[model samples]
Target: MLNEMRALTVSELTHQIKQQLEGTFFHCVVEGEISNIAFPASGHVYFSLKDSGASLRVVAWRTQAGKFRELLRQGEKVEIRGSITLYAPRGEYQLVANQVSPQGVGALYAAFEKLKNQLRLEGLFEPFHKKTIPAHPRKIGIITSQSAAALQDVLKTLRLHRPDIETVLYPSLVQGADAPASIVNALNIANTRAEVDVILLVRGGGSIEDLWAFNDEAVARAIFASTIPIISGIGHETDTTIADYVADLRAETPTMAAKLSAVSQDELRQALDLFEMRMTGVVREKVTKYRRYLHRLSLRLQAQQPAHFLKESRQTLGYLSEKLEHLMLKRLSCYQQQLTNYEARLNPRHLVGQQAMLLQQLSGLESRMADAVKRKQTQEEQRFEALVGRLNNLNPLAVLSRGYSAVKSGDQLISSVALVNQGDELTIVLSDGEVIARAETIIPHENSPHNKGI
Candidate 1:
């Protein structure tokens, strides 16, 4: 009795009932007169399917009131085939029509559905089967009627944005009986040649009968099987066909198809700037390493004799300095050339401004580099001067200032009597002057005044 008395919330009961009714009428075919019809901007049709006995809510999604926009009318007798599903939010049951037709005219629509369902079951329309559309295609292959206005639209768009990219046209019938075969052949030829990076399957807007070729099984299969990614631009934004689903990408119009194939000039400029920044970063890293090496060498100088080490290190530092200067100049020149080349390719709109900015930046960089080199040179010079001052203090000339002298015979220093002969001419170097003298009599060490008792 307690089990029976247990209460269910309104939401829980509604959900249970929704599941039961939805499952019970999963697939249904209803023949009724249309009433309470509302066509919303989202392209989903809302209407009630009514007969004398009952009226059921029905929606034909994305049909846009069929190809000619006159398929459904108030009180018009029609058949809708779909699955029953709960709207959930309103807790109302409705029919989600996958196929809708006005009595006898359904034969063609039925065939479209048949092919769509079969291909869908085979997973051709799955995201996994779709190829990635190239972000920037170097060459785009166009497949359309030679006389098509859509072809002109595509060409004009590509020319406006990316005139550098080449295009190859494979003229094929876009309509009528021979179009399917022509399209298939074009696709096959494109695959065989593989000249283009991507293919644009395009046509002008038309009625369902006029656009029937794109729905052909052979065309759909060809599009799905192509090695090159295919972008379908068939009919207007509201129109949907089998090829649109099978394509790697779908554009609403022929112009949009071309626009999608290549990026804009602004994007290219940004890429160039990014490349320049990365290159600048590399140069900065090299400069930092060289500076650190110089710093390490400077620290090592204090512990070792500067005379010999400075001579050898000075050569190395000079070479490295010249090498660094040459490398920087070359890199800057390369950047200038690259900017000039890219500028030529880009649209002239605000191009002068960009070039000016880059030039300013380049000038700033050169100035900074010069400053860095100048500072480094000044630091090294200061360090060298201080080292020379220390060396001078240790020099014998400092001792000669306090009543001492150095005597030399020719280029040799006469340090002892054994180094000089009698009457040898000598040049004595004092602190501030030199004197010419002669060793008139060479005395033994024992006979010198310091060696004998005073």
Candidate 2:
């Protein structure tokens, strides 16, 4: 006996088959090298996963693609977690992948480590080779994609910390095969200008392949060769590259880099206020001491009046004259007695001996007195020369001869930006000449591009 046959449309058959495959293979894993990768405007990623034995069509829709787009590339081995499904229109079977990750020993990753070790042996990663990031900088340079999220992060941070800090952007391709060359060129441009105090090399977080440009040998060597200091903020906190090792400083993210490069103006203003207070206190103390000294000097001068000193001197001279007249009369009587005794016993030999002895004593005393006076004069001369030498050392003009200049506003020295304004006249005193100029700008050290944003 024969049964009645029921014919079905292609649409109906395809739909039924799709349901069966989806139901039976609810979940599966595919490990293979990726090929024929295509990312259309729709945001869905289509690629072929191939092995030595066979190939399978795979699709990662927009949602899953977005999660790991930076991790995908052609020829890389990857493990796809997905469910098998049938495409009714094409009459083909494909895998709809929900997750993707690099398979064992990702080729790009192996190369990265190999190169890293090679460079390490060559001492490229040594700490001594790294330059010091300036504590204060006049300008900042940035190297990144103009439209990259990393650039925006850094700029936003800079605005928050120090808007006055000047920044120069060197745009470049931060991903793809040609990204290495673009980054190298940007580095070169920054070095040529040499205007910025430090350069920030930054990019958003990505997989090994996306961030490979920073791992290039050329880029690493260029960073090493740069005379200006460089800060690397290439990826997420967990992500590190060769550039990070070569840079003067490493920041976990672009925003962190900007914060590291500038200081808060409010904090600096507070510090300046404290310094002014201290200086005022010191000056007041000095003024008080000087006033006291002048008061004491005035009292001393009043007590030493010339008229009082003259009257005292005249009275003392009259008394001394009267006493001298009495002493001279007494001495004359004693001398007459001594002379009569000497004449009774006197001889020529004895008189000659006494005269010679007195002359010898006088000569010795004179020589000793002359020697003491000569020594005192030499000591005073030596002390005067030493004082003159010290005075010269403290002279501002002497300092100018050693390549230092002093800026003065009127007669006052200009030590800080707070003391001057735009268009103010200034005198710059150098060793050999003076320059009359106008203050065109006032740049505070704390507001410089390379200060800690305290």
Candidate 3:
């Protein structure tokens, strides 16, 4: 058989072997831990899958790599499904992965998926559990590595925003096996002291391994349990960790965390200056408006003054006095003319008869005049009594003396139960004193049996 295939070109022999391998392993699934991962600029992932003295070279193109990016990691166990292929240029045989997933997760990414579903069902990521950050925090606590450049960035941003805010640093390891515990301890310390208004857990950006501590369940639980609001600034804007989901706030960076926690002093100063200027302008406008109103009122009052009224009254009185004097003189002249006329008509010897007739007429006139005077006096007395009764009815002092109260709500009278509700504040006016009370209950007039007066 070897002689029958002799003298064949190297390419032909390799092709035959490639064809045999492809037919033998048309479609297969392999499980192993990832090692020697290399992502080249050619947009292909090259890695070796090894487990106990055996390794297979594998290649996943950019298309397949995208789907498995979240689930694949160095040293992580995985299962890959693909077909065997040969590269003619390099004359090498390799497995081309079509689909990749975490090992044994064909049953469903059971462990990862189970934890995600459980946490979601527990409402750990609900919006209602989110706490609002203080608009202006008096103090900020930082949980980070003391030697990290992240600390310096946070401090600088804070100083730029609000210099008066007190910063308390709780030093902790941000990486390595102890990082999760260190972070938890720092959070506990911050809570116990209660000196900080808000806590910020921050770290600089790094590779997935460098940021792995933030994904620890212990750290996530600690962040959730903290009573004080926490802002997490763990990595770059693109990075997300389990701690980021549980934290009250997520900031893009350490500088952003500081900026969010405090208000900018320059901005505040500018705002205050703007407010002061507005108030000054409003007050000045109001004063000018009121002054103009007062000036007009003063002019009107001057025109209506009592002195001007009194002077007009004096001129009217002088005119009435002159007319009264002229009328009196005319009446006296008419009386003298009447007397002369009567003397001409009377006889010199019949003076007694005329005197008797005059006395009778005089007596009749006196009787009529006396009756008119008595009627006038009776009407005047009745009018005076009616006036006195009306004055007594309108008197506020009289009502107060009778121990009656006049309650007022604002400037309005309080007369009905429908006007107020429970917990409404009221001003109660009694005859002797005033009391402020919040209404605890309102016994409706229709519902109260005592109000029936039985």
Summarize candidate 2's per-residue lDDT along 1-454 as a digit string, tens digits: 2367678899999999889889999899779999999999999999999999999999999977886676579998888889998988799999999878778525666788888999899998899988888766789899999999999899888887778889999999999889989998999999999889999899999866778899999999889889988999988887789889888899998888887776666666777899999999999999999999999999888878898788889999999999999999999999999999889657888888888999999999999999999999999999999999999999988999999999999999987777777899999999999999998866668766533332
The alpha-carbon deviation from the true structure for residue 265 of candidate 1, after best TM-score superposition, in angstroms, is 4.1
Kindly report which residue stretches of model 2 are placed more than 4 angstroms away from their true locations once superposed.
1-105, 262-267, 270-285, 288-292, 307-454
TM-score of each: 0.46, 0.49, 0.52
Candidate 3 residue runs with Cα over 4 Å from true position: 1-116, 297-454
lDDT at position 200, candidate 1: 94
The segments of candidate 1 whose C-alpha lies over 4 angstroms from its true place after superposition are 1-105, 263-265, 298-454
Each model's lDDT comes to 0.87, 0.88, 0.85
- Local accuracy of candidate 3 as per-residue lDDT tens digits, 169-214: 9999999999999999999999999999999899998755678788
- How does candidate 2 fare on TM-score? 0.49
lDDT of 1 by residue, 1-454 (tens): 8888879888888899888988898898777898988888988778899988998988776753464346567888887778898877787888887766665546778899999999999999999998988878889999999999999999998888788889999999999999999999999999999999999999999767778999999999999999999999999887789999999999998888888777866688899899999999999999999999999998788557768788889999999999999999999999999999887768686787889999999999999999999999999999999999999889898889889999999999876777777788999999999999987876567766443221
Model 3 whole-model lDDT (C-alpha atoms): 0.85
